[model samples]
Target: MVQGVDSVRQLFFGRDDAENDLTDGLLSSAVFRPNYAYREVLSGRKSLIIGRKGSGKSAICRRLAAPDGHPGACVLITPDDAAGDEIRRFELQGVTADTAKSLIWRYVLAVHAARHLALHVRAAHGRRSSRAVGALRAFLRANGESDDARLYDRLRRGARGLQSANLSLKAFGIEAALGVNGASEGARASRQLEVLEDGVADAFASLGCAKTHPPLLYLVDQLEQVWTVDADSHALVTGLLLAAKHITGRYGRAVRTALFIRADIYDTLNFSDVDKFHSDEIRITWSHDGLRDVALARARASLGAELTAEQLWGRVFPPSVRGEPTAEYLFGRALPRPRDAIQFLNACRSVADERGGPVITEEDVLAATERFSRWKLQDLAKEYLVNHPFLRALFAMFENSGYFVTREVIETRFEVRRQALHENFPAYTDSLTPEGVIHVLYEAGFLGVWRGGDVVYAGGIQAPPGPGEDEFHVHPCFRPALNSLGTERMTVQQGALLRSDVDGACERLRRLLDRAPLPAPTHTETLGEVLSIETEALRRKTQGRPPTSAQLRNVATHFQTLADTLRQSGHVSHPVTRRLLDEARSLTRTAGGAIGSGQGSNSEG
Candidate 1:
């Protein structure tokens, strides 16, 4: 039987690589791993979830937040996901970094607490949770609830309507949130903050009176995004940590806050009381076995009852020419991150689709390397763009160069060109020196140093520094993406590396995945459409073109799904709910009409 994109997607078993376990509904999703890390965070023993990107940090937070038979409410605070809640708007113009961050964090905590407290009224029915919060309503008064669109929806605005008391509380929130004030005003707000915290603590303390009180789980994610601006980024993350630690300490019985942060960022961050924070930290790690399990789980999910986990993976990944399971040939190409494994597998599937083969062949696996490498290269750029603003120039330094280079050649290769720039310039790295540039590249996973015959990918301690460390090879995975020494976009396809090869490889990936029409999306605005539009957009983005017709179709499809989900969720308290589905389906119709070639269909998007 012939296999292609449709078969590959069918094998996905409803798994969208683009989605997080949270919105993917982790509670019911088969990717659930009831491992130690899950238990530790769920039990409130570890508040910090640290991992490299795509290592399942978000999954852990979403899992810990599962409300299925879980004792308490879960208020997930992904600050970036919430529109209108900019970190900048919360900052004060004239305050110490610590004070400004603390005040913003405090206000954020209070608003979320108020929102969750009211929403969790059902759990608090036999107890005085509502009364405890209501009694302190005066203290909880804040003005900014209206600005936060999410506050109205998630905050449970039903129990008490637009009464003066609720209005007063909102006003109080606004007052508390306006932390940009004179020193004296700041002091006054601090006093009000103390009272609010005391009230929340007291309310949580009284929650034990309930039949089976669930601990309030606050899953805070996307802390990396908080680094959007570094001016006081460190202070901002610190304040969040301190705020969670302080508040959760008082109400440990009823409150558990888990913060998901990037491992690389966390490793380099400096803050006050850092050790204490480190003590309770849990790292999200991935091993060969664990990642295999993840792949098997996904395969199991896709194949469902037709094949068990082992059977599905066995069929998909047979023995390769190397006399090893094709799984190793595929998975070994990646670092131990889910993103790496998933992308590698996707690339293999794409090649198999391109070949019209039901199963991935050895040649298909080998050909997929160039594209997979390109993805990792872009992944590096996107993830590190903020932290290392000048990383591109560093990457360009590798263009056209062959696999091996000495430290002197690397420094000489880029230094004369690099050192001319002002030290303060964003593109200039003073550390472009021999040792420094080597370490930076190693850490970025773009290059690896060699000791005798073994390659060292790590930049820290394990890095080969002594005698034979002077020479290294450009990490083979990165070779396909780098350009020729001076030209741009001219990728090396003639068994030689070029600067432009990486630029063009990902476009090929798009074609590989975009084969065949998608199945009919359940919700007009389903994740399927989003993935479709986004996938098509990837090629255009690389070519520096605008969104293509396929992308618009996807956008419309996604909007429809979202509208349907909102309607079916049955809790459309927002005014938009009245006509949300109609507007969404309208978009679906409009978007569906844009695509040509009979491409737009309920089952084809």
Candidate 2:
């Protein structure tokens, strides 16, 4: 039986979040697309997976921890708020803040490795454990690392151990205090951590785990839950990077570490060693094809049927949305990532279900677009809230403006709000300048720079907007929420040709709707739908080709209807209203006449 809208909505798309999606949801082994980033991590070549929020970092992390995941046992560490507080407050007197944090992380990793080794050595390598393995068990038991305590509790214990240099190293045969009495606190702490790590390494070596078994994988994820925009947070992340690198080399092939970090948080690190991890950094970016593949896979997984992409997209969902292929329209407007795609696809289905549909119609997708845009806009701000707390406040600068803007326009907009922004966020005034705001917005993917005939956003190896790049376009993902749909400022000459006059008329009507007040919701809705249809038809107009006589006539009919609707609304006879009415009626007559004479005219009367 063909799946109905209710089933498609309820079953076809999984939960928006991968965490929830993995448990009794659709993000199973069947639907998870093992993209480049996942492959890099799985191969142990990339330990730092950076991506924008909802870019599938956690999904990869969780997938690695699944039973069918990595060849080796996986330890997933997701710090909660309590654990974050402990790390943020941790400081050592004789070491840098980053070093102190690294030591703590090393302790955590070493303990996790030790625990894994103790169990593996007995379970797989036989119950007759080696002396080194026995020592790890003793050490874990003595220091309470053996308990299945929460991450916060473990961090608290490790923090206390490192702060006091009192980690029971007796298991490694050092029953008494260290002889380095005159050393700084940092040296003492480092020496103690080294002892524990050495013990863990010894166990790995003794059991030949490095040679006989796949490396134990440590997957640290969801640091954004604990992240803040402060010196401590910076140190916290920098420390983890250093620690992950350290243990990867220190434990040799016996252990591997991967940290799935949000790009916004990762980009904020500025320590001297930040550049060293370039080789290990794999940024997650989803292509249109990749997203489509994901959508198809998820749909198939949900239906438990071998549904082809065409059936899922063309049959289950409308074939096209607003004159573009449904897939293109959907993914193009979303930040290219799994989470955004999932949320949007599911939202369309939900809307369709509510409207009592067997399939997701164009109306459902259009309605979902606005809601999704609002969600993404708010999410974009929240995604960078730790680093760019003023992000939400900056949205007002783009709201109701054209989606396409030159650097000059943005600067002018920022200039008007610069003082207020500085006053509101004095700590961030340095980044509140026009140039600074542009760069920030560009990095956050809220804006894309026009370069080399394409709108390039962040990720995908695209360079940041340079000083010479004057043109910028608000990302489609955010345009609807900002009500900035007009593309008047776009450099259309760089693309295929467009019918300038009809396009202009459409733009004029949009501007009129934005400026002039209508009588009621009914009129506004009717006019909005008409304009939307006209825009879609225009989008379908072939590139580099003039509108045919039939197309012109169709447009003329739309304009005539628009003119009549405006007249009936009885809008105030203001300049904007009069110009809109005049433009619509004139275009109707001119286009209609051109078609009647079997000639096409792409001009306003």
Candidate 3:
């Protein structure tokens, strides 16, 4: 239950990504969580695993692709940027975009299957390669697919062959290459592809691969690396779906395909056959208990100890942070995903280690919260950068503001920056509107809406914020980074009304400095900064919530003292001095009005 800094340092949560985690990090097949998605894919009951980034889609894909992980052979196909570009730019003159892309995907899967069968017949069946398998080997060599090449290279070759009718069909008993003289381009391509697929299917049937060996499991993951917000991207993904569905049917029980796609990208796809995929879709969701199990599993794997949740949470990490159970404080702040939980838990461990602790303390966890919050905030922006490039700009509206806000308050903020936002991202102007931005924020998990009694984020089956719905809370994951921890709503009382007067007074002072330059440049600069700092501090203190009446009187006294000092020092013009004094008196009167109206204690932030 207790360990030195060395032991704490040795305790690691796996890497953020599954690829690295499996190779050199703490993750291993032993600790893999065989969740519903993994089970469904292995059982061939579901082929689509949809979830947001960090929801463990890649973890399942990587695990399934490992040796001894899948019952049969496994092939993982992850397209790089180049392959994505090839898929996006691919077009056929005689076919719809969807059909055209589907053909390419089918071609890729067929090639991989052919290659697998060419070797499997001898290795698994323990017999001389059958004629069908030989034909597959010949087809592979004839098409330059015999050698190991990058996915992009293979896609490029396949696309060229399909588009120009250059594929070698002689392996299928034809004497020459496929010619494009008989049918339209799409028809010709489809027919040629069908011939190749049939050749592969023949090999599978001849060896009785389906009945003899486990079905070949094909995994397609990380499509988001090449995903974009365009029609071509949509077609690319749609084609993948169509191709995966076709593989299951075309090869009968010989081949199974699973596509791990981001939820945002998957939700954008629309096609007539979409309904048919309903049963095949399995969304990756993580519960708090699920995440805790994962953490404990990984902890045991890393530390070589079967630490219980009680020991891990109580001895390793603090039992409580900020008066809440440490587990709740940690998991409740993170997006309900494995990666987020891993990163947060690792951060706490790292902080404790850095402080030379035998075990993590409440201070360590609190310090880690700030660092984790900043990471999640920036990561949220990067996660949506491809689809929503203007996301980072929107964070400024929330910085230093309250975590809880109403639609009206957000709209007021948005209206101030509407024109500039449109100009900055003119291409996305349609989505830069107040409603559009709200939806984007909500969908990205930066903001959660209060529904019923609890706040619900975007990953659930809930609809987006409705027109009639208004209350929103920033996800706790991003609160510390934005310095927006206050959650109480400010009442519409005199303290709230004085908030604007205080802000206006500060703005007036800034404008006066802009208009009047003090005679002594250096001294003026020093004093001006001091005055500005004070004003800014007050403004931030009451930024998104009401200022207390006592706080306003303090501000009024500070402003009057500052104005009088500047006048005595002869660093300000008489006009500026008079304006400052007037503003100070105005704040004083506002503070008196707030207290006299019995509104001083009504508003709290």
Q: Which candidate achieves the best lDDT against the true structure? A: 3
What is the per-residue lDDT of model 3 for residues 1-605, given as tens digits with 9 covering 90 to 100? 44432448778888999989989645566788888778988888899999999999998998888876888988889999999999998888789999999999999999999988877777899988999999999999988999878888889999998988779989898877676676777887898899999998898999998899889999999999888899999999999999999988989999998899999899889999999999999988888989998998998888877678888988888789979999899999999999999999999989988888877889989999999999999999999888899999999888887777668768889999999899999999989988998999999999998776567898757799998777788999999999876534444444457767876777777676667645566347535654664566565444443455556666666666666666667645565666766776677777663211111222212
List per-candidate RMSD values in Å. Answer: 26.3, 13.8, 13.6
Over 4 Å off, model 1:
1-9, 13-29, 69-71, 81-86, 89-95, 125-131, 137-148, 151-183, 209-212, 306-314, 321-324, 399-404, 420-427, 450-453, 459-473, 482-605
* Full-model lDDT, candidate 3: 0.83
lDDT of 2 by residue, 361-384 (tens): 889999999999999998888777
Q: By descending lDDT, how would the candidates be arranged?
A: 3, 2, 1
- Per-candidate local distance difference test: 0.57, 0.80, 0.83
Tens-place lDDT per residue, model 1, 1-605, is 11332345455522333244445543354667665667787776788888777777766666655656235677777655232134433444345665656665765676677656655655565544456766454443443342345532422331121211223333234432323233454454555566556667666655552235656777778777556545466676777787788777666666678888887777766766788886779877666787777776765555453344444455565556357676665665676667687777777777887777777667777778778878887778777677666566677667766565656567677666665433645444556566666766777766776664466665224544554456566665676677422332222232122112222332332342244212334333333444554455465445433332233344445444444454456534433332333433443354345322121223322
Better of 1 and 2 by lDDT: 2
Considering summed lDDT, which 10 consecutive residues are worst modelled in model 1?
Answer: 158-167
- Give the TM-scores of the predictions, in the order they appear: 0.66, 0.80, 0.80
Model 2 Cα shift for residue 110 (angstroms): 1.2
Higher-ranked by TM-score: 1 or 3: 3
Candidate 2 stretches greater than 4 Å from native: 1-11, 486-605
lDDT of 3 at 518: 56
